[model samples]
Target chain A: MKARVHITLKNGVLDPQGRAIANALHSLGFDKVGDVRQGKFIEIDLKESDKAKAKSEVDQMCAKLLANTVIENYSVDLVE
Target chain B: MKSAIVVFPGSNREKDAEAALTEITGTPPVMVWHRDTELPKVDLVLVPGGFSYGDYLRCGAIAAHSPILREVKARADQGMAVLGICNGFQIITEAGLLPGVLQQNAGLKFVCRNVNLRVETSQSLFTSRYEKGQVLSIPVAHHEGNYYADEKTLDELESRDQVAFRYCAPDGSLDPSHNPNGSQRAIAGVFNRTKNVLGLMPHPENAIRELLGSTDGRGLFKAMAEALAA
Candidate 1:
């Protein structure tokens, strides 16, 4: 089993790295790109065979350690 | 005054903090490891700066859950004076001992330099040695020193005088250019609601001696020592 998680800065939080990417895109003539927010994608290989159980464990991981709810939100996907 | 400095695995500033406290308090601080669930009874707790847990997951996030902080937090709730500096500041916030989150620097650059900070209040145990509105020259070294909090929390911080320091120009003006990390409202330091916990980005311990460029940071340690003695 495997789990994938995506972590992103919550809305209304200033994304300086995203803004820097947007500026760089504009500089390179990608004028249509108005915004670019950066995020993290983490893949975890799980030993648990139960897909439902693995998803629940991953969710706990996201809430406890993988994502900081104060500033970042996370979504988890389970794959067999 | 007996003081304890919590030392996480990656905490490099523990010695500096220990040295500063010993100089002022005339007694060495007990080095408490992160794995210890028990701490020696002390008048003050100092959380020094460093890349704890190699700054994995997020800065200070992993360190906040360390067993030692559990005890530290409990004591702080009972009104123990806790001082968190730089990375230490981030840990307390992640531990929920302090409000707000320190995000990456606005410019996405590591900043290390001397900054002028305006003292906002002298009523707290941390800044009582300095007069209100005094400009302090302190060195700050961090990559993620930008402070952020919700609007309501920010309002409360201002209304209740929880803001301990703000970046300022030499003439005591609030200038955006003087804000090295783009912290909200130029905040350099803040105190908890009970005014027992303080978290700041600047390294006051690094500036406690005149030969080290400035002794402006001595007042903060002196204030803590004097308060503990009293």
Candidate 2:
């Protein structure tokens, strides 16, 4: 089993790095880019075969370590 | 005052903190490694600045979960004084001992220089030796020192007098231009709701002696030592 997690800064939190990336894209002539936001993607391999248990474990990981609830949001996906 | 400095693998300022505390208290602080599960009894515990855990995942994020932090957090809950500087501030906040988070600098560059900080209040143990509104020149060196929090939390901190220091001009004016890393309301340091725990971005330990270009930071250590001794 495997779990995939996506962590992103919450809306309204200033994302300077994302803004800088957007500016770089604009400078490179990618005029279509607007309001870019950056985040982290993490994949974890798990020994648990139960989908419900794996999801719960991964959720705990996100809440405890992967995502800081104060400024970021996280979503988890599990694959068997 | 008896003190301890938590040393993470990548922490580089533990010596500076130890030196400052020793100079002010006439006693050297114990160095506690991150892997340790117990901390020696002490009046204060300092989490010094550095690229802890190589700033992996997020600044202070990984170090926040280190074994020793569990002890630090427990002692903090029991009214022990905890001071977190720079990356230490990020760690404590990530550990949920403080509100808000430090994000990337708004200018997108690492800022390393002296910034004027106005002591917001002298009521806490950390600022008792300094007068309210006194301006001190302190050095802040971090790429992610910009402080961020929701409006409600900011209001709560303000109303509770949890703001310890604010970046200001030489004359102690809260001018936006003087803010080095775009911290909210120009806040440079903050106290936990109980005021026993303090986390600030500026490195007071680095500015303790006159030869270091400013003794303004000595007031903070003196204040803590006096309060703890009493």
Candidate 3:
């Protein structure tokens, strides 16, 4: 089984790196971009065969280490 | 007074912290490695600044899970004093010993310079030597020193008088211009609810000697040493 984790800064938290990316996109003439927020995408391979168990384990990882709950939020998806 | 300095693999400021603490207390501090699960009995645990674990996946996020921190956390809960500077501040916050998180500077640039900080409260063991509202010149060197916290947590921190220091103008005004990293309410340092754990972005160890252009940071070490002796 495999899992993917998406970590993103909370809505109200300041995202300076995302702002820089947005500015770069604007400078490149991609004016269609209104507001942009950047986030982290992580994929992990698990030896566990149970999809349910894999998701629960990845969820724990997100809460414990993958995401800093104070400033960022994380979501987990298990791929069968 | 006895002290131990925690040294992560990528930490480079342990020597500076050891030098500062030794100069102030007349005793050398033990350098504890990240892999060790036990810490020698000491009055204080100093987490010095540096790019711990190369600041991967967020600053201090990797090093926060190091084995030694478990001991540090236990001792902190037992009322032992723990002072975290620069990257150390990020680690303690990630370890849940302190509230809030440090984000990148608003300008997305690595800011390095001398900034003024107002001693917010002298009630904690970390800032007892400085008078409330006294401004001290300290140097902040980092890219992610901008502090962030939710409104409710911010209000709680303020009302409980847990804020240790705030970035301010030389004359002590907290205008936006004086905030170098865009920290919430210009907070430069914070104390845990118990007041024994302190996390601050500025490099107080770098400002301990007069030859370093300012001795303003010495007051913090003095306050800790005195508190331990008493």
Q: Interface RMSD for candidate number 3?
A: 0.8
Stretches of candidate 2 exceeding 4 Å from the true structure: none
Estimate, for each residue in B1-230, the C-alpha lDDT of model 1 and write its tens digit. Answer: 78899999899999999989989878899999999999899989999999999999889999999999999999999999999999999999898998899999999999999999999999999999999999999999999999999889899999999999999999899999999998999999999999999999999999988888988999999999889983
**Worst 10 contiguous positions by lDDT, candidate 1 chain B:** B221-230
RMSD of each: 1.5, 1.0, 0.9
**Candidate 2 C-alpha lDDT tens digits along B4-39:** 999998999999999899999888999999999999
> What is candidate 1's CAPRI-style docking category based on DockQ?
medium
Predicted complex 1: DockQ = 0.72
> What are the Cα lDDT values of the candidates?
0.93, 0.94, 0.92
Encode model 3's per-residue lDDT on B1-230: one tens digit a residue. Answer: 89999999889889999999999978899999999999999999999899998999989999999999989999999999999999999999999999999999998889999999999999988888999999999999999999999999999999999999999989999899999989999999999998999999998888987787899999999999999973
Name the better of 2 and 3 by DockQ.
2
Clashes of each: 0, 0, 0
**Pairs with steric clashes in candidate 3:** none
**TM value for model 1:** 0.95
* Candidate 1 wrong stretches, greater than 4 Å: A49-53
